[model samples]
Target: MLREFHVHDRKALLDAATQQGWDPLPAEELDEDDLHDVVGAVMWLADSGAEAEGADGLLDLGKARRLRSDEGHEVAQWSPEPIMEDFGKGWLHRASDQPGDSDQSEERTDFAALFAAEPLHCDDPECEDEGCLWQLTPRTADLLHTALTVLADEAYDDAEELGDKRLLEGEHEGNWGVFARMPKLTFAADLQWRRRFARAADDLADDLEHDRWPQPTCTAEELALHFALDDARDLHDELGYEDDADHTALPE
Candidate 1:
């Protein structure tokens, strides 16, 4: 009957199977609707740059599910996620032993020293109480930021397993609360240190322009690094994770 109906009037057959009728329950004849949805989903995946099949030459349902889920979620909310190429090529490559690193090490000394120095302190003559913030340099700040960001953004499966272990150990704190704070703090501190690096970069640039440093304090690579850090800092801000005005580290 279905084949005959399809041969004569395919559109009428599809409507009869999928569209609402007096019956509340789905008609047993509605396999056509399921087939229609599956076919439509496959077409959408193809249009969205998704691979149609896996290595085994079978349709990849896992990818289809993920794409559908992401599309639904994105309609409600969106986030700026780290791109794999950006993380691997730009940030990780610089930190690893690459050809540019030899010169990078030598040039980074001055900025590294500045980064390693004690944090902001009160030097006011009128003030009786002197204070200091976290002893975080730009290098250390970058490390902490990268670690926490990866933990929150990429390593959720590992984090979930770790949470289970913590629960077994009788940890009173919920994993969600415990895991959430570090990324927030590190993100704030990264922005704070970016400003410091930018100022130092400007100072170094001025010194180089005026021939003040017979031995330049920072190399071109280090200056480039400072600007890169600044760009990352600005990106976080644009993503709506506003930098903490206090610029103080959260207690561990």
Candidate 2:
């Protein structure tokens, strides 16, 4: 059976896992066979340690479902890349260092470019003119910092594990700099990216606030809530679909 736990932070996540009789399993350490046991185990951390603090809700990977549409068809899947792309196209507009089909490893500037973009402006009337650009909410700042740190750390660890000398320490160090000094001005920029993505997400839904939701809607937020409530997990387990190798595959 799947278990749900409220982890207030990264250390709490690890502590909970240890108490539950499992070691802290990093994302790179898991294989296909470990998905069932490990996804909900530590996968929640991928969202950001900030999310672990309960601002984003509990860790309940056992309940996630593909967002669906009004026609009973699944909606487009959400991923971070497109949002990153929008960060460049809509905001930063930085010149591509290696344009065209350059591989990701060769074109690692996206992270920095996105990070350097201006932050979202605070909507508070008192802070309107001055803007929260220089003073982002702690939660927002933590989320971005954690995302950069975790990504860089995982990449560095992976490089070391593979004994890839081509991966230099400078790469990790540069990302660490951004992680450490991310300013609030950049929050407005990132917030815009999120707002655009959220709007795109909303367009995919039939009706988000409907009374009979959990049905016509397919927003990531709603699905997340359903997972938190264990409704999705119970339905998934009851249907015997949880055991399938491709449990996440959408219907044709």
Candidate 3:
């Protein structure tokens, strides 16, 4: 039935409509306009589509097509790309650095490309904990900053977890440079210190990648959102100690 519509076989559609007892017009008495109208209505019956589940009303037209179409035929079985199948229903990075097909990884830039700065000295000698620091590129930073802020704001008008704590001793700089001190972040009890860091990460990403969405949806925003979730995972260890982070979290 669907094959008729896919191939635009109006004659086949008319035949199917007659077999199903759905003919609305007399074939022998009809003018060309009447036949056209009946065929067009049959075209709709061929669709038989319904709401796609769990996609927030995004139509899953392909699913309906696959189901109603004959399974015995090879054409009915289609598949998505392998990368999409394994990428955690995840996303691809936008503004991508296209690699040569000869050897895709050969010219690939290392993760260091994300950094804008590196801290030479240990941020805290007082606690005797050793550390290294690297800042994310401004583009990457905005992506991370915005996604986390959006998620956090959706959770709280003034989220404590989104506190922009100062990680290093230098003047506030880089994507990771949130700059609030730890009291609310660590203790989660100090209202005063909590007040300091509140809403720091909010609106961080609004002007950057988010506003440009659909004009050109940025892949960095998705990556940043995942990274922020990682930071939020171990809240117990993160309390009061901003320097304990092995690597940076979603930046300020």
Candidate 4:
């Protein structure tokens, strides 16, 4: 069924299920809705230029429960999270690494500062006056964000997992706490910090554009990633969790 999309490179993905030990729909059942979804997902993956080899790990991300906007574009990443606290402000963007990481571990060297720094003024998130908010220093923010990102990931992993797609759109509107769902964005909850986070998200989007990052396509994988990243950043939010805003992060 996926072959109807005319994606020449799909030999890899089509054959992937066999190697991964999942059975494709039988020829007689090719017209089933489930098969159609799987095929559509595969086509979307093909359009997004995703490498299907690594996908051998899991195939359910493109499933119905995953996140994807109505647009063909997937929200694979949230590239700007201007974390603020008593420590001050620092930029954060996820790279499919733990949301705790400033970048990847290889790209990060804040450990020396992170370890030497003062412990969060209040390690307890539920502490009175919120001492945890004071720990938002660059190093501390990464540390804290990492901790929250990890904890959330663990809890949600029991929840589920998905791969990265990449969302780095244009200038996000911070006023109403709205950011680009495509490219990289979403509501930050703290309306005051929304401006900075919006800028940061825009800058990250620019960088991705300059680097020629691939645009998202209408595929199962890309769609799954977009929803995943959106959910990931929402977990560590200082304010916006309950205000009827959407904050999604990756499960995997």
lDDT of each: 0.35, 0.35, 0.38, 0.37
Q: Candidate 3, overall lDDT?
A: 0.38
Candidate 2 yields a Cα-based lDDT of 0.35
Determine which window of 10 residues in candidate 3 has minimal summed lDDT.
Answer: 58-67
TM-score of each: 0.22, 0.19, 0.19, 0.22
lDDT of 2 by residue, 1-252 (tens): 133444445455555444555544565866777543434546444433433332234322221332224435433345544332232333232355233433333322222222233554766756655445454232222233333333334433333343322323445445433221223332223322333323322332212212112232444334323322343334445444464323222221
Q: Which ranking of candidates, highest TM-score first?
A: 4, 1, 2, 3
lDDT per residue, candidate 3, 58-98, as tens digits?
11111111211232534324555332234345434344433
Q: In model 1, which residue pairs have backbone atoms overlapping below 3 Å?
A: none
Q: How many residue pairs clash in each candidate?
A: 0, 12, 3, 20
- Candidate no. 1 TM-score: 0.22
lDDT of 4 by residue, 1-252 (tens): 012233344456666534544456567767755553356446445555554542342222221222224434344455375433462353353546443333343343343343333455655667766434443233333323333333333323322221122223433233112233323433223322332332233333232323322243434224333443455455456534464122221110
RMSD of each: 20.8, 23.1, 19.4, 19.6
Model 2 residue 200 lDDT score: 28
Indicate the TM-score of model 3: 0.19
lDDT value, residue 115 of candidate 2? 29
lDDT over C-alpha atoms for residue 183 of model 3: 22
* Runs of candidate 3 exceeding 4 Å displacement: 1-7, 27-31, 34-41, 47-251
**Model 3, residue 155: C-alpha shift (Å):** 33
